[model samples]
Target: MNFDYTLAFAKELDQADPLASLRKDFLFPKQNGEQFIYLCGNSLGLQPKAAREVLEQQMANWENLAVEGWFEGEDPWMFYHKELKSLMAPIVGASPLEVCPMNTLTVNLHLLMVSFYKPQPGRFKIIMEAGAFPSDQYAIESQVRFHGYDPKEAIIEVSPRAGEYTLHTEDIIAQIAEHGAEIALVLFGGVNYFTGQWFDMEAITKAGHAAGALVGFDLAHAAGNVPLKLHDWDIDFACWCSYKYQNAGPGGISGIFVHEKHFTDTSLNRFAGWWGYQEAQRFKMEKGFVPEAGADGWQVSCTQVMPMALYHASLKIFEKAGFMETLRIKSETLTAYLIFAVNQVNKELGFEQFKVITPTEAADRGAQVSIIAKDKGKEIFQQLVAHQVLGDWREPNVIRLSPVPLYNSFEDVFKTAELMLKISKEILI
Candidate 1:
């Protein structure tokens, strides 16, 4: 309850943290012999120290066993991804059989669409947010076009009311209700990347189901950033990339979840590959595709062991830190402190020089805070970077600062605010 911005207080909180020891697991970035205040985890997470060892093990297997690494090695390359399901399932609130790690985010999205988006006459539309990531927009548009439907007609995008930066839950629900009957699929980001607004997946899924549509989510920013209940929410399917909050390095392998009820739906269509073939009979080189029941049936190729190993190293840290509960507590306080500090700085500057675009309520948002500098957005952002306060710039004016609970400290948030104050003064003059 007590939010103090003192160095002694921050050190005390760090000492009391159960997950404090987990910080050592990562290789923090340094600048000019000093550690950089990394508030850019939303873009790319810091490297895990254990990641090197894990990847090295795979390198040794590839060296010593050669092609035999697929079957003869200690951890067979063919089944490397199977080891990750148990660790990832709980993170997304899914059954172990309902989840699998394979392919990339956009690739998996297209793959899932093949199975879930069955466009029937008169009811063949896809509903999504208007300001979705460009990749998602492209995927949805391409999918609609591939099905011989005009994207302009088949894609119904929901946008915020005038002069608003974030979408409201009520507005989203109303939009779904208005078009649900004609929509074949309801796909949306679990959290809007730019606004940092966490959508109500359960409510949206329920609305879609009530209107005879399938629901899916792209959880690139939400997967490890917040607690999810995908299975309990009865979400039909979902996909996510692990490079961001999952800390699995750049271009890491992605994951997907399919409800158990859909596992035996023989009518569901998919673009099958050998990897999805039944594991028991796969070696026999069967004539037809007999998919391994559940989400594993979606795998299109053999696992990429190096990225999988990196993911394993990070998942191990999540496991040791008690996953979401421990991290969520710290995330709430850290983000609140950052917002509070930023506001304090703005008041001292004699005018509203900066604004947080993220939701004010912690329950409605995640760890990242997107800020817009009123006068010199880009100039102020560059100054902050020059001061060694690392955040990311998005388009014309926004700067995203993510205070990750796993490694980012209260002091980092304080220092970033101080740097912003100094930068603003220089820019205004």
Candidate 2:
């Protein structure tokens, strides 16, 4: 699929896009008077237009039904999460019973670790990627410390080879096997937040199991950005935040997946609460905690109505767009065009001013394209924003841009690269 770096070409592509109408479903941010070319969906997705309507409905329920809203409303708050499970399961490739929307990502990770991260005499270590998102690092560190083990010795970090920015699959597998003997769990992000590299989850899961360890993923960046098969992959557990690619609003509700195979395992420990108790007997205020069947058993508290409403709005859009596989087709082409446009910028300047650090293959990456600016990176990024080309900047010199298939058109990508080229020229001069 050859790509041209012309606005006319971009418009032509957008004109033929089947999902083009879906763009109107969101409200883009504005700087000055013009709408921004938002390429920061990897960091924070734009708000869905339906967000207001859904939120108001829930608010109205609170006004009209009062406390009885839990059971009396059209969409009862008591079983609200059940409505979401069917929508969310398709995003992560799981059955309805295998996924549940509950606590935030790290919070769910902590709960899952309590059940799966059982460190024993010979196996007390956890293996993970180096430079993981700080929350994961902190959570794993704290968990190891809580079990009376020093993090330095109990955690094994797999790093990229010298001078390389992304990890190789074989290297990751080797690390798992190398530490297999003492490893109790293997955890990794489905797609790295910094590099946008989509790790091979099935491969990792198989390796983790072969090494006699439970496997889990933090899919904060991967959910709705790429196609996942958590259930088919035989992953032990996984969790994700909905704010980014899922577009569920800032600090939106998070979800968890526990394989159906683990559903009846009574030996598994959990921080139990009334919300997770057997639904029929919950009103009886039973003595011992009896967890509900399936992934709902992992719930530590009752449903979050407002946040779930926000998430439902976005999931409906995904449903309208025909879910992840449909979106992935556009995302691959859109992301490829981004890489091409950035490469064109460097070619026109007769120097590699912007270096793309993400994997080139669509199979190994998602919508995000992280680039390292060779000169005046921060200045260039600031100017891009000032000019209404909104992308995000990381520490050091990386600028992250994500052309979300659901909202961002090809013209948005083209215009952003054009502004970046102009900014780079001005900064270098």
Candidate 3:
């Protein structure tokens, strides 16, 4: 598909889009009394218009039902999180029993580590990509230290080859094999938050399992951006925050997936709470902690009703949009167009003024395409923001832009490119 960066072409494609109508689902942010061309879904997704009603309904439950809201209202607080399981299962390609919504991403990561990342005598190392999200880095380091080992010896970081920005699959597999003997766990982000590189989970899982290690993923950026098959891939455990791609508001509910293969593994330990006690005997407040049948056994607290309501609103929109594969189709074309338009700006300058560091291969990346300006990346980012192009900038020299398929239209991408090219001439070039 040859993409044209002309104004007419952008508008024509948008006019013909089947998913165009879906943009109405979100409430785009306005600046100077006009809507900004928002391209920061990678950081935080736009709010679903239906969110207000969901919140209001929850408020009504509080006002009308009072203490009885726990079990009597339209959506009872006692079992509200249960309602979201089947709705969100398809987003990560897991069965209802294997998935549950709970604590934040890093919290769930800590809980899962308690069960999966048991470093023993011979196998006491962990392998991960070098520049993971800072929180993940901290979590792994703390976990390793808590086990009474130095991080320098216990955490093995797999870096890219010289001058490369992304990891090649072969190198990742080789790294796993090289350290296979001493590694106990292989934890990775489903998509790198900075580079937007989507790892091959199935291959990674196979390699980790063959290496006699358990595998898991932090899907903060990948959950709604790409199709995943946690169960089919045989992942041991996984967790994701809903605020980014799932569009559940800031610091929204997080989800976890634990394989049914671990359902009866009594050897595994959990930081037990009454919420994790067997449902039928939970009210008895018994002395012993009997776990629930599946992934819900990992849940340790009462559900946060409002946050789950916000998440449910977005899940309904996801169901309305059909499968995640459908969204990926539009995301690929839109992000590819962004790459082309960014390149065209450089081509017009008769040099590579901006280099896109994100992988060009569709399978290797999701919605974001990270751009590095030759001389003025920060200035270029500021200019885009001033023009109401809502993209975020990273440290050093990278500008990250994501033309989300949900709320961003082709014309938004076109206008962004036009403004960027114009700004390059007026300021950058």
**Model 3: clashing residue pairs?**
none
- As for TM-score, the candidate ahead, 1 or 3, is 3
lDDT of 3 at 154: 98
Instruction: Pick out the ten consecutive residues of candidate 2 with the lowest summed lDDT.
Output: 420-429
Q: What would the TM-score be for candidate 1 when compared with the true structure?
A: 0.98
TM-scores for the candidates = 0.98, 0.99, 0.99
User: Residue by residue across 1-429, what tens digits does model 1's lDDT show?
Assistant: 676656677677777777777778888777777777888888888899999998999999999998999998778988778789988988899888999999899999999999999999999999999899999999999999999999999999989889989888788888889987789999999989998988988989998998889999999999999989899999999999999988999999899999999999999999999889998888898798999988999888877788899998898888888888778999988888888888978877988888899998999888899988788899888887777788999987898999998888877887788788888887795
| Ordered list by TM-score, greatest first | 2, 3, 1
In model 1, the Cα lDDT at residue 324 comes to 88
**Cα lDDT of model 2 overall?**
0.95
lDDT of 2 at 130: 93
lDDT, candidate 2, 318-363, per-residue tens: 9999999999999999999999999999987879999999999999
Model 2 TM-score?
A: 0.99
For model 1, which pairs clash? none
